[model samples]
Target: MTETLSIGERVAWYRRRRGVPQEVLAGLVGRTADWLSKVENGRIELDRLSVIKSLADALDVQLGDLLAEPSLLDWTPDTLGGTVPKLREALMDYQQMSPLLASDSTSRPPDLEILRTEVGSTWSAYQDARYARATRLTPGILAVAQHAVRAYEGEQQREAQALLAMAYQGAAMVLTKIGEADLAWMAADRGLAAAQESGNLVVTGSLFRSVAHCLLANGRPTAARDLVVASVGYLENDLADASPTYLSIYGTLFLVGAMAAARIEDRAMVNQFLAEAEQTAQRLGHDANHMWTAFGPTNVAIHRISTAMELGDVQIAVDQGPRVDTSTLPLERRVRHTLELARAYSAQNRTDEALALVLDAEELAPEQVRHHFISRHLVTVWVRQRHGKPSHLLVGVAQRLRVIG
Candidate 1:
């Protein structure tokens, strides 16, 4: 009956109500038991409306039943596989434990050097599209970083808090992508508070970027664009002497701003932000992942293609899709771009092209692409228009996405 149950949890609830075993239901739905398990645990997104309808038919219930939100879980600890619930517990646990530990001056904190490395690793997981796994790690990382902030001295304390801020931002980034906008906002707010305490401009801008991202996910790209436009000045400091880190974050913020403009179909703001992004990307000259922002010439070109898609210029997106070299992009970025290209192809009535891109993206990052809410929708739409049975290959992929029974 909860209003916020995630797609997976609702599926689980409906299945349980029907007294369906996971294996039996998987068989009925033409999906594997493992796939069903992942969906039930929230490892897979139940996004595509067609697939949800298919599930409703297979489970003998209304689609609305499976679409209901989950019962919110408290941190008092019943086991949870979903990331955000566990994150809530970790955040609450750290807030309580850090202050108590800080009261005792003699208690030794975690190693600062190690914590920094873990923060870097956490970012890697996020960039690789291991979103759920990243969420699972972030709260613990945040807790440790917070502990270090209280226990360390002077410069070390600042670095600890900054790393703590990064952890929160990482949580926000992953959560937003996974459709947890409210929780993403909470994590972003936490990051901003910690960044302010650390007095780091780079962290502050990065956290602002996270806040903007949460806004976009909540379907307010105009507000998101406004946020990026207003806060653009925050990163302007030290541009002349900007390190690769600064250039990367600066370019990424504009890239985000450009994306926001695209979502709301604000062509003028999109061009302006993209122009600014181009300047920053050109300054870098080549692809470089400074602070995991992955800002550079190639990334800028990719964003241009994405922008065109957002603007409903499908021809432009299709034209640009083949020209760009995708070899240099990260797995997650490449997969997302490929999927976006598929969307463009779909829009253009190029079913074969769209299907190819979807398959390629799925091959590259199955967990990311196949489990996305959009993936199912894409596959479902693709299937419905076929002259007859699709090729075996397409059906295999559709089956994996649970788009066909």
Candidate 2:
């Protein structure tokens, strides 16, 4: 007779099949490799519900699959008792739509009703955190979402698949912002896989564009460019012109292409791609907000300023930089925009204006100002040039920002 596997054994088996080395899997799930090894060997018990769920997610297995003891099925109902019903419900809900919540506009009311009923208490906890809770919940949410996608694969539920993909994408964005680049990439990969399997060309393109953006942020612009170029065929071939989602995805890809081109010092290609993005943006109807154009007009303008700065077009950067409404931009993006403006002013030999802009940005978000790549780089360059007396205003701003650090 075959030996029955415990939950730990099952988790280990699935993780191995997924080709995730213990060390890498442990790091992704925020556990020590040794501890994970002990858990797998059945020498150590995992009691924390969150940790168990995180493990299940990393292994791409259902939570029940990890917890199930096949030989224990003969035990009385009291053995598992009150938790069994909840576990069954969670499994069933995970099967239906654990990752993605149905959208009000896109989903049928009945389908939404089913999901709402099935998700139950879990949904409440998931949405409870109000402002900037990405740091706390992103990893757990991502794990849950990934597990949901794994469960629903090949089940012919297009809506469920799309929702799961969106969840993965959302989790990835949160992770990326929180400085978990590898985890962010993994989340993006899961989203891309689901998007491809669901045959949603718009989603597929958007996922790739997101992955490229992550890569670009992680300092691999070449890899980012390759991903974008690879995605173009899918975007052009499978996407319909009437689909605003598709157009928005294409426009984002072009925006990234322009940035990548600028990174590589290819001014001609950068201009060409930006022009293409502009044309695509023009074609987008009023409904483009539903697509991946979350950045929209302000974001595009910010990129224009950055690109102009990179291409030595100081006049263009200055003109467009001020046109962006700083109030509407996110704290991080606004800081970056201000830093770019500072760089533009510095390039124009207006050290006083550049320092003043930097000071303003520091006041908005001191932590953001301190860690900002462009601002730090610009200041370094300006200081090295010994551009006049070191401005007292800049010194005061730096001292205040240090308090937050």
Best model number under TM-score: 1
Global lDDT of each candidate:
0.75, 0.59
Off by over 4 Å in 1: 1-82, 97-106, 371-373
User: How do the residues 201-261 of candidate 2 rate in per-residue lDDT, one tens digit apiece?
Assistant: 7777778887986775454666777777778866677555446666778878988887877
Candidate 1 lDDT, 1-405, residue by residue in tens: 543345666778888988999998888878999999997775564543445655776788754455431112222222246556778777667443467644545668889889989988778887787766687678778877877888878888888888888888888887766556677788888888988888888888888888888776655677889999878886786799988888888888898899888876678988999999999888877899877787888788888988887676879989888788868877777877788788878877787888888888887766576445456556765565567988887788877765565
Question: In candidate 2, which residue ranges exceed 4 Å CA deviation?
Answer: 1-132, 150-158, 174-180, 238-240, 285-288, 295-298, 324-335, 362-370, 379-393, 399-405
The total of clashing pairs for model 1 equals: 4
Q: TM-score for candidate 2, please give it.
A: 0.59
TM-score of 1: 0.77
Please report how far candidate 2 places residue 271 from its true position, in Å. 1.3
Itemize residue pairs with steric clashes in candidate 2: none
